[model samples]
Target: MRIFPARLPDCLILQPQRYQDNRGFFQETFRAADYAKAGISEPLVQDNWSRSVKGVLRGMHFQRLAPQGKMVSVLRGEIYDVAVDIRPGSASFGQWQGLVLSEHNGHQLWLPPGFAHGFLVLSDVADVIYKTSAYYQADDEGSFCCFSAALNIDWPVTDVIRSAKDAGAPDFSTVFP
Candidate 1:
């Protein structure tokens, strides 16, 4: 596997080496020692999967009490994935990065704790799977409007579908749906 440093120095974009024959291909998505060598020390403890259709957007979310370090990749279809550095005292605070992750690309993104994670489905349907360093705590989760001007993300699509909670968030409720 090869790891590429992203615009946000703390984040990483990984390309897993694939070996192929006539039948199919094989790749190792995670290897602890390799990651540890790359400066990722968190031990992943949970895995989550989400499937969404095109035009669906989910999150700009993070957990205040238990911020998670996540390794995200797509299992099927495609998506525009984003990670925003929200750590108040960090050099990259308020900065964001976006990447196109598709099954064909076979790439993965790593966002350490203190970053808000979000994605927009770009295929008919997309299956996103991620491993996190910390367990989820619903009561500790915090979210910002995906289209908040404070962040002003250049999402590829305009007509999007959002969950009520996201749509009702401070800046999104009255504007930019």
Candidate 2:
């Protein structure tokens, strides 16, 4: 796997080495040794998957007390995925990076703790899967409005379907403070 750094300090774009044949293809999505060699030592505690239709947006979410470090990928279709740096005292604080992920490319992103994660479905439907370093804690969960002016994210989709909680998330101006 090739690990490439994104604009954010700890965020990474992971490109797997795919072995393809007429029959199919195989790749090691996650290998401890490879990750450890790259200086990533986060311990994954949970895996989650979600399916969303085109124009659906989810997140900008994180857990303040138990921030999650996520290894994210798409199982089907495609999306515009983004991660924002929210770590206090970090030089990249409030900065964000985006990438286009699809089943065809077989690429993924690793977003370390102290970042907010979100995605916009770009195909007819998209299946997103991820492993998290921490377990979900309801009380610790928090989100910033995906369209908050302060965030200034350039979402590719004009029409978006969002969860009630996500739609009502505090704006970055309020949430970041």
Global lDDT of each candidate: 0.89, 0.90
The candidate that achieves the highest TM-score relative to the unseen native structure: 2
**Tens digit of per-residue lDDT, candidate 1, span 32-51:** 88888888899999999999
TM-score of each: 0.94, 0.96
The Cα RMSD in angstroms, rounded to one decimal, for candidate 1 relative to the true structure is 3.0
Q: Cα lDDT for residue 69, model 2?
A: 92
Question: RMSD per prediction, one decimal?
Answer: 3.0, 1.0
Q: Where does candidate 2 stray beyond 4 Å?
A: none
Runs in model 1 with CA error above 4 Å?
Answer: 172-177
lDDT of 2 by residue, 14-69 (tens): 88899999999898887878877777799988999999999999998998998999
Best by lDDT: 2
